[model samples]
Target: MGFIIKLLLTGAAAMLAAYVLPGVSIDGFLTALILALVLAVLNAIVRPILVFLTIPVTILTLGLFLLVINAVIILLADYLIAGFAVDGFIWALLFSLVLSVITAILDMIF
Candidate 1:
């Protein structure tokens, strides 16, 4: 139940990012929900492997590189889905950060 709420909140955050950032585009609520699910799965699945693979870079960058990884994951999701487009790498990174913060806040509030 809580996980479902989180997904909805995350989708709302993604939609919000699309509104805030010109480079990020979401079709609508349904599309946003799908994108949110993809992002969550990516963060859970691919993210761990990525963290392990990029451990050296993560260490070198003092964990800042994780932001880049987050962006990449978002971009990958955008590419995988229709009507969900992230324009640039940096834009993706910013969008990722905003969505993450929103989800965290929502999690706390709920």
Candidate 2:
């Protein structure tokens, strides 16, 4: 199904981020897959609420605040997932950015 493809792509992106970013660590492909699934769920359920709550600041920052939201989501995932780790806020931000870019590229390619 399409969802499975997306999940695999997201896992690939997470693994790619782990490879490129020193501060982002994923224990293995299975951990990356789990992280991807958790991130998808959080983004679907929690992200919209956070985005709605931060609308004022998000508008003031001209949408850049979404990066912070993404980072927070990553941090939350790191906290919940034992095999996934983000060193700090900066690392989370970078990992989120890299993951986004990689996923976007994969989406486009496939």
Candidate 3:
């Protein structure tokens, strides 16, 4: 299924992020898979509400508030998944950006 493939790509992206970014850490492939699944689920269920609630601020900030929204979600993923961690809010933000772009790229390529 496309959804499962996306999750796998996301897990791969997380692994790549851990290798590329000092601020991100993963215990192993299992943790990467768990983190990816948590992130995807949270993004599906919680992200919509958060986005709607922050719409005014997001609009006011000229859509830049999306960066903060992303950081929060990454932080959530870090908290929910054992053996996977982001160093701080800044790290979470950076990880989210890198992970998202990498996942998109990998999905397109493979």
> Top lDDT: which candidate number?
2
Better of 1 and 2 by lDDT: 2
Candidate 2: segments with Cα more than 4 A from true spot: none
Point out where model 1 deviates above 4 Å.
none
Which candidate, 2 or 3, has the higher TM-score? 2
Among these predicted structures, which one has the highest TM-score?
A: 2
Q: After superposition, how far is residue 42 of candidate 2 from its true place, in Å?
A: 0.3
Residue 64 C-alpha lDDT in model 2: 98
- Position 14, candidate 1: lDDT: 86
User: How many clashing pairs does model 1 include?
Assistant: 0
Worst 10 residues of 1 by lDDT: 101-110
Per-residue C-alpha lDDT of model 2 across residues 1-110, encoded as one tens digit per residue: 99999999999999998999999899999999999899999999999999999999999999999999999999999999999989999999999999999999999999
RMSD of each: 0.9, 0.6, 0.8
Give lDDT per model, in order: 0.90, 0.96, 0.90
Better of 1 and 2 by TM-score: 2
Candidate 3 lDDT by residue in tens digits, 4-63? 887788888999999999989999988898988898889899899999999999999999
Per-model TM-score on C-alpha atoms: 0.95, 0.98, 0.96
Candidate 2 lDDT = 0.96
Arrange candidates, best lDDT first: 2, 3, 1
Candidate 3: C-alpha lDDT: 0.90
> Between which residue pairs do clashes occur in model 2?
none
